[model samples]
Target: AALAGQRLDVAAEAASRARALAPNEPDVHFLSGKVALARGDLDSARGHQERALALDPAHSGAMNELGRIRLRRHDTAGAIRHFINAARTTPGEHIYSRNIDVVILRTLSRMIYVFVLVALLMLWVPAVMHVDRFPFAVGFGVLAAGAVASFGLVLLRLPREARGLVRRTLRTRRVATALFVAIGGVAVAFAAVAFVPPSELPQTLPIAILITIAARITATARLRSPVSKNQRPGDRMT
Candidate 1:
């Protein structure tokens, strides 16, 4: 059954028939586990699925089901790992894509909110009160530093070996990268104008525009074409 909530008896019968037809088939065992899961026999479901996975490490279905079970049990990190492995094996399934996307979107949203709040604090805390002699410089310096760090983070590829770290980084930094780039550009522009001679402002504006253009072009190129050397699309596999 495609749906996981289907009748277990029916699924079990089907799995039995399948297993009879192909004894030792990993998929048959996997199907039996799905049936058990539908019947709310989690322990049984896990046993069958684990057996299936033991038979075939790359069994995407077993991996995904294990991921689902782990998620239901509140093992979010472990569940994410299983899901990531399933995605890596199949790389083209809609279910796997959706799972990863859901995880990533939720994590990114939370991180973005926190990063924005922090950015505001960095900009406002010293400048509004004029506590420091170079309050603007201190604030803008922090902004620029954050920007560079955030940009570098986006460019870092997700490590297949470090699934948890990669997942968290990808999930949190996806949209945060773009936002930081914009903020970085503005900060750079302000810094240049503040420091550069008034006569240089005309030249500085063009350079700032050039920087913006370059960043946009870089981002677009990363998106529409094959990955450039040392760079990848935000959502691409590492």
Candidate 2:
């Protein structure tokens, strides 16, 4: 109740009493860890959570709390390990599964930002240098291929369980259609640059820019939509 009310001091007091009464109980330690986390005491939170896990090796709650602590500390990989353990331990828990998606989406968001910057640089540098059309077309084609390969590699590197989820998401009609259009746009842009005269190469820039913008918008929307759906009301603890 105190935790729900945002009263961290009261929650900590209650948690301490519970821990004293049941020192061996994993749930008690989990509660204490949550209270410590609420108070912004990450070290205490981590210690309590570790203690909970030691008491019960299969304690999914402890694993999930530890994941939260890791996330707070900006340890993305550590957090992912903990979350994956939690999900693997309790396969029926949708919350644990959602946590994995949250982390993956966050990583994808960062990748999108980097991809956009690199794509823009690829487009801008050649134009500024007044490179010939054929060379620019070849460079752009290479960039596009590299981007596609990098995205595929990221998916392939995901854990088997997560890889299945991502593959399903990509198979959705909307996402697949968007990807097809984006890829097609890039192919057409390359063809235009390759066949068109050097003076006409500038005309393809706007189409390329539009494709980039569309991709950013589509990716951002897709990333954000799942986050809202994953959030559960009144899920304050773990």
Which candidate's TM-score is highest? 2
Instruction: Note the Cα lDDT for every prediction shown.
Output: 0.60, 0.72
* Backbone clashes, candidate 1: 0
Scored against the true structure, residue 172 in model 2 reaches a CA lDDT of 52
Model 1 scores worst on lDDT over the 10 consecutive residues at: 229-238
TM-score (C-alpha) between model 1 and the true structure:
0.45
> Poorest 10 consecutive residues of model 2 by lDDT?
227-236
lDDT of 1 by residue, 1-238 (tens): 5335556676788787887898788988988887877777888889889989999988999998887776667555666677778878998875764565454443444444444445445433332453442665766677667755764564353335434544444544334464555456556654654566555556665665555545444433322343234432234321
RMSD of each: 9.6, 4.7
Model 2 misplacement above 4 A: 7-21, 38-42, 71-78, 152-157, 174-211, 226-238
Global Cα lDDT for candidate 1: 0.60
lDDT of 2 by residue, 116-227 (tens): 6566566665557877766777787687777778878777666666677666656655445545655555555445545656676588777766766676667656556532
Model 2: lDDT equals 0.72
Which candidate achieves the best lDDT against the true structure? Answer: 2
TM-score of each: 0.45, 0.71
